[model samples]
Structure formats: structure tokens, C-alpha cells
Target: MERDVVCLVDGNKHLYDRGAYLWTLRPSIVNRIRRDYPKARNQDFICFEHLLPYQVEMIQSMMRSDEKQIDKLNRKLTRTMEDQEYRVTDVNETLKETQTFGQKIADRVAEIAGSWGFIIFYIIVLVGWIVINGLHVFGITFDPYPFILLNLFLSCIAALQAPVIMMSQNRAAYRDRMSSENDYHINLKTEEELRILHAKMDHLMQHQFDHNLEIQAMIFEILSEIRITQKK
Candidate 1:
């Protein structure tokens, strides 16, 4: 079997870009067994059961790293983060998400401005402004006649505000796009790890089955030889 894989993190594993699997084992313990009982030194059993002391130490280091990561993550709110890469990607993703939200709000404002309802509301307000000013009721008419100027003024305000809002939204959209790309990559890696795990499991199981079959065949052969000897 091709044993090609890349990157294993805190019980999470990935095989290229085709699969991912997340699992956990006490590396500190298992690694220790592998190290302290190196198969080469103790050749009485299968190699899988023996371990080197160095291997155990490596597991201890890995455990320490995992613990530190978990502690860091517990203090934050993120999709998947507890390390440098995860943190960088998460920050980028957050920036993107925030930008996306801002753009959506800006889009809503633009839509409201373009709607007939908004226009009608402004018209009514303008009429009331005219009445109040012409009749001098509350004497609060700031801009009297030439309601066209009022329209012009409002238009100018929109012209300036719209671009500013849109500009802000545009910047945010760009950030979001970058973050989404990173997320996609990470997710892709995760998928790859999953596929890799299934493949590994299948291979391991098949190996076990074949091994059992071999043992059974050996037993049968021994029994057959015994019967022949008895018959003789």
C-alpha cells in the first residue's frame, strides 16, 4: 500500500487533498510503549506492540503541544483554531465575515433608496415642510421654497454617502473573499484526511483478515498431517 500522507495535528490527520480524519489517542502512553519496548530489541512478538523510548518522548512532546493549543482555543471564539495557521486563517475569515455583513447592510441601504416607498415618504415629508414654512406654524421651516433645492441637496448627500458606504463594503468583500479561500483550503485538507483514514482502516482490516486466514490454513495443515500419521 502507498503510505503517503501529509500533516497530522492534534488527532486530526490529512492525506494529501483527498481525505481527512479526526481521532485522538493518548500519544503520551502509546508512544511510551512503542519506545520502551522496541521490537528490534525484543523480537519475540509482532513489531506493532513494541516501541522505542524516543518514540515515547516524541509523544510526550506532542501531548504538550496539544495541551497548549487547547488552552489557547478555550480562550477564544473561532470555527477551528488553536495554533498559528488556524489563528491566522480564522482572523482572515473573521475579517471577511465582518466585511460581508457590512456590505449586506450597505446593499440594503441602497435598495431602500431605490425603492418607490422611500421616495414617497420623502415627498410627504417635503410637502409637510412646505406647509409648515408657508403657513409659518411652528416657524421651523429651515429651507423654504425652491423645494427643488431640497431634492438636490438630498441627492448630493446620497451621492456622497452611497459611494462611501459602497467603498467600505467593497473593501470588506475583498477581505471576505480572501478568508473564504483559506477556509476552503483548510476544509479541503480536512476532506482529504477523512478519505485517507477510510483507506487506512480498510487496509488494516484486510491485513488482519488475511493474517487470520493464514493461521487457519496452517492449523488445518497440521491437523491433516496428524491424521495421516495416526492412520499409518
Candidate 2:
């Protein structure tokens, strides 16, 4: 006949098949046992009746830890979403709001100067000037051939138009830079949010798997009890 094992907690004899050695228990369960029985050793035995409370405590502790972790992730995600709401803005509207009067004029001048209407109007003016001066139209001989006054006027307009066009172009470049920076910041935040979400998903999946195993173990224990009661 096999010898009965003595339980460490209750000091009662139990069949070897109905108890587990301390070393065979989960680390968390063993640690809980050691808290009460400071001198507990690996060779000590524990019956399922005494071991059930420690197993329940271990499962509860794991569930609480999972809840805390999930809550932390939720808080972090909420803060990220709140920050995004305030950080995003329309770049065009912001630029327009800050634009100086001179900058508006420059932009307007550049817009008109770049149009086909301006080109056609400019050609008509040039042809009129050349015809009037070269042909001495209506006895207006103030500007003779190679129109010196017209040349001077053209030079002055070129100097002024070039600087105005340059100013408009510089502002356009600044707007583009601001837009690109905004896009970069948005992309970075999106990436951070995605990473956090991914981490949360992985954590939930891992904990879910662990919980499923624990639940399966509890179901089997329940089934075993039901079978024993039926046999009795």
C-alpha cells in the first residue's frame, strides 16, 4: 500500500494522489504559502482544499494587475487624443491671419502679374508705346526712335516688380515650410498613437490567453468535483 502524505497547512494526512508537493505548485501559489508558513520547504505537501484559496488569490491578483495596466493605457490614449484636438489647425487660415498689409499687396501683385490677362495687356501697352514713338503718331514726337523715356520707365518698373515678386515668392516658401512642419508633427503623433494602440492590443491578447488557461483550469476542477460528488 502507498503511504498517505501529510498536508503542510492543516497537518492532516491525505492520499498522495489528492495533494501536490510545494515545488510542483505555481511560483505565486508557493510564495503565498511561504508567507504564512515561513519555514515551508519544497518537499512539503498541500492538499487541494488548502491550496484552493491561494490559487483564487493568485488569479485575483493577476486580474487586478491586468486592469491597472489597461487603465493606464486608456488614460494615455485619451491624453494623446486631447492633445491632437488642440494642435491641429488650418495652415492657410493661420498664415492669412498673420499676414501684413504689404504682404497682401505683394501676393495680389504676383497673382495679377502671373495671369494671361496681364501678359496680353502688357503686350498691347508695349506695342502702343513703340508705334506712337516710332511713327510720331498725331505729331507726338516727344519720345523719338529708341524711346529713351520709355526705356527709363521700363527699367524702373522692372526694378520694382522684381523685388515685389521676390517678396511674394519668399512668403510662399514660408507657407510651404509651415505646412510641411505641421504635417510632420501630425504624422509623428499618429505614429505614437498607433504604437500605443498596438502595445495595448498585445497586452490584452497576452492577458486574455492567460485568463483563458486559468478559466479552463477552474472548469476542470469544477468538473472533477461534480464527478466525485456523483460517485459519492
- Give every collision pair in model 2: none
lDDT of 1: 0.52
lDDT of 2 by residue, 1-232 (tens): 4688899997998777666899987777899999999889999998777877877787788778888998999999888878855366689999999999999999999999999999999899989999988988887877888889988998998999999999999999999998998888788789879988998999888886787688678657645744553552
Q: Model 2: which ten-residue window has the lowest total lDDT?
A: 223-232
lDDT of each: 0.52, 0.85
Query: Weakest 10 consecutive residues, lDDT, candidate 1?
Result: 42-51
lDDT of 1 by residue, 1-232 (tens): 2543433222233232222211222334344444544431211222111212333455455556545644544444233333345323565556546665656666677677778998999889877877877777786766666666677877997787779567666766776787777777777657655565555556446654554564465456445544543552
Model 1 alpha-carbon drift over 4 Å, by segment: 1-88, 91-93, 96-124, 134-142, 148-152, 220-232
Best by lDDT: 2
